[model samples]
Target chain A: MARHLQDTIYKYVTMCLSGVALALIFIIIGVLIDSSYPALVVYGSKFFTSITWNAELTGSICYTSGIAHMCGATFGVLVYLTGTLLSSGIALLIGAPAAVGLAIVLAEIAPRRLASPISFVMELMAGIPSVIYGFWGILVLVPYLKSTLEVGLSHSLSSVPIFSGAVFSAGLLASGLILALMITPIIASISRDAMRQTPEGLKEAGRALGLTDWEITYKVVLPYARTSIIGSIALGLGRALGETMAVALVCGGASNFLPKTFFYPINTMAAFIVFQLDAAFTDPSGMSISVLAEMALLLMAITMIVNVVARLLVRRGFVSRPENLIQV
Target chain B: MEPDREPTNSVQLQDSFSFEGPVRPRNYTRRKALNLFVKGLLIVAAVLVLYPVVDILYLFAYKGLQVISISRLIETTAGAASFNPHAAGGLANAILGTLFIVGLSSMIAVPLGVFGGVYLAEFSNDNRFSSIVRFFADVLAGVPSIILGYVGFLVLVLRFNLGYSALGAAIVLSVLMFPYTVRATELALKRVPNGIKEGALALGSSKTTIINRLSLKFALPGILTGILLSLSISVGETAPLLYTAGFSDYINWTACCHTQIGYLTYVVFTFYTIPTTNAIDLSYLATFLLILIVLVINIVARVGLRRLSRDLESRI
Candidate 1:
């Protein structure tokens, strides 16, 4: 009887407390949506699209009842999000093969001595703070790119797209480069593990078929590990999309319009919000723009969607979809 | 991280050779060519990734050592004007402010996160409660420091009347660090032996007692490593600090929050733009210091974790 009581109490305590944590998600959404009801009701979907982020410079004045002002701001986020995608995409391109190759080396070709150091370095890269990367982007990569390739590339691609000018921090190219560097390790790490976990028998079957090394890898190994690669890429997207400090530092703060040219400076929504919103966050009903909060909601929603998708795809379905791994 | 996909190449190479005589030489040449090509690609990629990082670290260390030698690293930035070659004073104030604020935040974050993790891991399993916690922690983890800056401005700055103070910055840092702590603690707790809990319960120990005594003790090393890692990260964060801590000029000796305190990251971020040699030197020193502090703490964390993992293995 006493034991039963203890078990009952344990169950009760566990049930109540465990639910509390998951409940935080609802709470944050509830509070965010609840608190912003005033703005949401006033703006509706206009919050997502309206442009100019005109914050009343002097005190929280109620006179500025213009939602049209934030059109630039809404467009600013889209531009920055695009920049995020481009940079992370480049990283995926560079890192995907390298990561897979490294995994191959470690699992198959490596002499066991080098694997630990390689893994440690990758973790270190991931662990290093974003601010440090920002510092490096400005001080190191910017100068190097300018000195080595900018002049030549500018002359050659003056008429073409994206690479038409000096490699500076204010454009989509540098911002993308920085974001790419940040996520390479992520994709590489995931792809490496997934590929390594391929069943031994799968490879043996390929061997029996007399397939070449390249064919076996392309046909059998990559196919087996495709879902994990997809998951990693998705996760990488989330990181690139939301990265603030590093992107802010490199992305020149211009929320006026999308970069008509890659060389021209542009501002991402996150960068613009960080740079100006704080200094002007106090006014009446739609007076001093609370677009920062609105932006945060959007970023949060994006993260949630990406994370949910990654997790769902990586469920048991990942294991079951061995044949359709690439589709994942 | 290097992906583990190269095994397929080797597997294919060995498999193809076992087939026959005629195709053997052709398969061998193709694979050898592919191997060479892949090796070349790996070399290029590694260099591309490694260069910028190494160059930045090289510049910081080369420049920073001169200043550190002249005035000493942490002891004094006072006689820094005349004694130090060209730089303005030392990083004393920024270092102090960073340590204090991050220290304060870690104190708050580590406990909240650990308890939250324990609640999820032990009581809730990875169920609705755990999943929700995980989601919030994740969203909170990724919810841009800039957004959290808005939270600090809204809640602490105006609503709580804290304004831009060290305490406010610390509060914001704590919030940002919360998700990491919870994630780390949950990971650490997951590494704990289930048998420990079962054994304690068999002896009639209360669930709370077992959680606090047995599981926590087992996971303490990992938890400590998590806390230190989180603290190191907080110390390096500048965005949330930018919004909450504001900025200060003079070295602040007091623990008061009415006035802002100088931090290395803020100095580095802001001063890097100004076209002054002093500003440039100061920025370099700040970046170097920021990197140094994180490196030391991270090394300590890795060492601690290694030792703890060994200890746990021995106990098992």
Candidate 2:
């Protein structure tokens, strides 16, 4: 009876504690929904489709009215969302092949002694803070791209819309490159694990059939690890989409319209929130704050959607291993 | 001729064609070229992935070390002359503020996360409520941290009028760190020996006592690692703090819940933008310090976990 009572108490306590941790998510969503209601009522779907983000400089007076009344500045998130997708897409395109190649090296090609150190370095890179990447993007990478890469690309691929605009130091291309660098380690680590799981017997069978090493790897090993590799790519995509400070630093922060060229200045949803939220609070206008909240909600929605899809692809019905082996 | 080459077996082979010829040589040249190509690709990829790490570390060390000093570590930030290179101030306030805010948040997050992990690992079965919590926690773990800052802005800063308090920032950070702690603790607890718990239960020890006395002791190292890791993450976070803590030039200690706080990451984010020598120097210094602290924590957590596992194995 004493043990039973103790068990009951323990269960009750743990349940309550876990509930508190879980309820935080609900609290966040509740707060976002409640505060962003005004934006929802005013902008509706237009908030997402519109590309204008106007902020009145002289708006310290009208705290009661929405931002439109306080300043002539309009708030739309279409451009930011487009920039987010474009950069993330470019990041994935560049990162995926490089990650796969690195994984192949680690799993199949490199000497065991060399593989471990390289893997360690990559993992450490993963742990470096995003702000550091942003700082680097603003300083070293932007200049290099402007002076070298962009000039070269414009000369060769100038017929394409993405490569047409005059290349600036900080723009979509810079963010894409920074994001690619940031996510390469992630995709490589996951893909390496997945490739490592490929059965040795399969490789031996391919070899016995008189296949070359590259053929075996490309045909047998890669095909076997395809699902998990795709899963890793999805994970990288989710990371690229939501990464803030780094993207913000290099994305050029222009929210007027969708970027027409790779060199066009752009802003992402997260970056938009970073700058606008500060401005909104600095002024404390009702409309401005609500609009920021609305943006936050949209940003949350996009991140959550990407996360869910990625998790589904990576983890759902695939509980054979830990999906999030690399902590953010 | 040897017995194996004798003609007796050839006539019994039903008169099949018996002349053997040299087999065609395998295309070694093409295969070798392919191998070389693959090797080149792998080398290029490795270089691509590693160049940034080397570049960033080198730049940070070269730039940040020149500005770092004992006085800089202990002195207050310059109030008005923050951007002035000749100002007589340092990062004492930011360092202390980081410790205070992260320390407080750790206090809240560690206990809840640890206990929740224990519940998930020990008490909760694959029930609907537990599964739901597990799912949401997984999603929450992936939630872009900036969104957490926004939510904190709404609920804590705007609604509650807790304007830019360290407490508010801590709350947001706690939320951000919560999923990670729970994951680490749960994983650690799962690693604990089930026999120990069973033996305690057989001795008439209650579930709570078994967990508290037996399981928790074994899992302590792992739990500590998780907590330390979370603390590092909190220290490095800038966006959420920007929304909740708000930046302050001077450290405000007396009113922990009501006043703004400054941190290393905030300095790194805000100061790097201004085109001033002192501001840039401060940014670099803060970046170096933050990275150093985080890397140290990561090394300790990994090495400690390794040693703990080894010790556990020996005891077993």
What DockQ does every candidate get?
A: 0.24, 0.45
Each candidate: RMSD to true structure? 6.7, 4.8
Residue range A169-238, candidate 1, lDDT tens digits: 4556567678777776666666666776789898888877665655677788878878877777776777
Clashing pairs in 2: A54-A73, A54-A74, A66-A287, A67-A287
lDDT of 1 at B17: 65
Q: Model 1: runs farther than 4 Å from truth?
A: A1-109, A165-169, A204-216, A281-286, A314-328, B1-28, B69-88, B250-257
| Model 1 / residue A91 / CA error / Å | 5.0
Clashes of each: 22, 4
Q: What are the lDDT scores of the predictions, listed in order?
A: 0.64, 0.78
lDDT of 2 by residue, B14-85 (tens): 477675443322565677688789878888887877888889988988888998888778777765245555
